[model samples]
Target: MEYLLFRLYGPMASWGDPAVGSDRPTALRPSRSALLGLVAAALGIRREEQSLHDKLAASVTFAVKQYSAGVLLRDFHTAQVPSQDKKTIRRTRKDELQTGRLNTVLSIRDYRCEGLWVIAIELTEDAGWDIRQLKEALLKPKFTLYLGRKSCPLAAPLSPKIVTSDCLRSALDTEFEPILKDSDADRVWLPKSDRVTYYWQGRKEATNLTGVSSDKVWDDPVHRQRWQFSSRTEHSASKHREE
Candidate 1:
C-alpha cells in the first residue's frame, strides 16, 4: 500500500485538551483530531460539513513517530471581555474614562517548545481523496496551516512524500531511523474497531499523552453528524528495512 509522509516541526505548538478550567493543557504529540483538522483545512472543508468530514475520517488512517517531545512552556495571559450591547453595564471606577466595565481574566496556556514529529497517512480505496490530491492540498493548503494553534506556526515545510509499505511500522522505520529498543520508540496510535489488528510489533507504552482527542471529525458516517472517535491502541514495534 502507498502511504503519505510528512513532518510536523515547530518552535511552539498546543495540541489542546478538553480541560475546562483556569489552565489549558497540550498533548505531547499531534492528536488525531488535529491531524484530521489539518487535512480538512487543506481540502477546505468547513466544520459544519458533517457528511464530508465523516467520509474523510472513516477512509484514512494515520501513524505518528515523534523525534523530539520538546519542552513544556507555560504562559500566563490576561484578556478583557467586552460587555454585550443587550446587557446593562455596571460602572467600575477607574482612573481613565476608557475603562468601560470589562472582565479581565487570567489564563495559563501550555505549549511544546521545539517539537518534532513524522506523520504517515494511509488512505483506503474508498477514501474521500486520493494520495496525490492530499499531497497537493497539503503543499498548497486552502487555509494557513499551523502546528496546533494559530500562534504556533510551522518551523519547516511539511515535505509530504509517498512511500510503499506493508504496514504502519514499516512506513515509519523505512523513511526514518530504527527503533533501537522498545523504550526508545514512542507509541503509534492506530484507530480500531473491536481490537487492533496489524503486523510486526512490540508492546504498548503508558504515557500521559492521550489521542482519543475531542477534535470532531465527521463523527457519524451514517447521518454525518456530531463528535466521535474510533478507539486506538498505542503500538510499538521493532524497526524494519526494505529489501
Candidate 2:
C-alpha cells in the first residue's frame, strides 16, 4: 500500500553481473544485491551486519524501471596483485602491506553511461526500518552513496518520496515517463508486448519474464567475509512508450 520512490542517475553506473573473474562484467540493470547495499550504506549499516540485511531483504519489496540502458563503457585497468596467492582482492592496500611482491594484473570493468533508473521500494510488512527512516538516511547518508561502484558517484539526488500503490506499474505510471537519451542506441530492451517486467522474491521466471521468481541476495557480506548471497524473492516491471 506504501512505496518509496527514488531515481538513480549517474554519468556512469556499473551494475554487477554474475561474472566471477578478473573481468568484472556489469549487468544491464541494477541487481538486487546492489539495491540492498545502497540502502545499507545510506543507513550507515556495515557490511558485517547480516541480521540487518536479512530484515531489510524480507521486509521490503523492490522494483526498478530501466528508462535508459545507456552505452557500454569498458575501463582498462592495470593493477597490482599478490604474486603468491589469494584468488583476487577487490582493493589493494599500501605497498608495504603486501605479503609478497606485487604483480601487475589487467582488469576490466564495464559501466553504463548516461543511464537512469527509477526505483520503487515497498514496505511489505511492519518490519525492518520504516520508510521515513530510509528517506532520512538517504537525505543525510552517513556513508557516501554511489550508483553501483564507489568510482561511479550518483549524478542526482535520490529525491525519495512515499507513494500509494499496490503494483509497480501503477506506481510508475502515476509519475514516470519513458525518457530516452539523445542517442537512440541506448534504448531499453522491450518485451514482445508493452509490459513492465517485474522481479519479486521467490518469483519464478515463467515462460513470460513479467512474472516473479526467487533470486539470490548477492549483497550479503556479513554471513562470511566473502561474496555471498542468500535467497530472496524480487519482482520487476516494464512498459514501452510507443505501445
Candidate 3:
C-alpha cells in the first residue's frame, strides 16, 4: 500500500472535540475533519464546494502517530452576542458584535502547547487524487495552511513524503529527520515520553493492525459549511520506543 506521510508541529494546536455551552475542548490527536480541511485548503478547495469536499473526505483515511500531544492550555474569551435568534445568521464576529442589544458571552477554549504529530494518508479505491498529487499539494499549497486555528501558525514545514508499505502500521512507522537538531531538541517544548500512540480507522483485516481499543468518534465531516459531522469508529494502539 502507498501512503502520503507528513509531519505537523506547532506551538499551539487545537483538535476540537464535540463542544457544548461555554466550554470548547480539544482532542489529543488531530480529528478526521481537521485533516480533511487541511488537505482541502492545500488543494485550494473552498468550503462552498460541498461536493468536492464530500468526495475528498470519502477518498482517504488517516493514521496519526502522536509523538507529543503537548500540555494543556486554556484561554478565556469574552465575545458579544445578540439576542438568541435561530433565524439570525451572523457572517462575521464584527457583524455579531454590531447587532442590536449585544450580550456578553464567555467561552473557554482549549489548546495543546507545542504539539507534534505525523499523519499517514491512505487512499481508498475511489480516491479522487493520487498520493503523489496530495504530496505536491502539500509542498506548494494554494492556500496558507495553519495547524488548527489561524492564530496558531506552524513552527516547521510539513516535510511531506510518500512511502510504499505493506500495511498501515508500517506506513505510520516511516520516519523523517527530527524537526530540530539534537542540540536544539530542548530549545522547544516536546513530550518526554518515548511512548507513541497511533489512531486510525479501518477494518482490522484490511489495515493489518491489532488495535488495543476502538471507539466511535463524531469527527467525520458531512457538510463543511453547516459544520455537520457523522460518527465513525477509530482504532488505537500504543508502542514504547526502545533506546
Better of 1 and 3 by TM-score: 3
Candidate 1 regions exceeding 4 Å error are 82-99, 174-243
Q: Alpha carbon lDDT of residue 20, candidate 2?
A: 68
Candidate 3 has an lDDT of 0.87
Q: Model 3, residue 172: displacement in angstroms?
A: 1.0
Q: lDDT for each of the candidates?
A: 0.66, 0.69, 0.87
lDDT of 3 by residue, 34-69 (tens): 899899999999989999998998799998988889
By lDDT: ranked, best first: 3, 2, 1
Clashes of 3: 0
**lDDT score of residue 9 within candidate 3:** 88
User: What tens-digit string does per-residue lDDT give for candidate 2 at 1-243?
Assistant: 777888788888998876667898887677777888898888887888777877777676677766676788999999876665466553647643556676788898999887777787777656678888988888899899998899999866787888887555566545543334557535654222233343444334321344344545454333523676554444454445553
Maximum-TM-score candidate: 3
Model 3, runs deviating above 4 Å? 85-100, 205-211
Select the stronger candidate by lDDT from 1 and 2.
Answer: 2
lDDT of 3 at 228: 91
Q: Write the per-residue lDDT of candidate 1 for residues 1-243, one digit (tens) a residue.
A: 788988877789898665466788897777767788888888888878877887887778777766565788999999776545555454654422254657778999999887777788888778878899999999999988898789999867888888987655557544533223467445532211222222111123221222332223221233324544443444432221221
Deviation in Å, model 1, residue 113 alpha carbon: 0.8
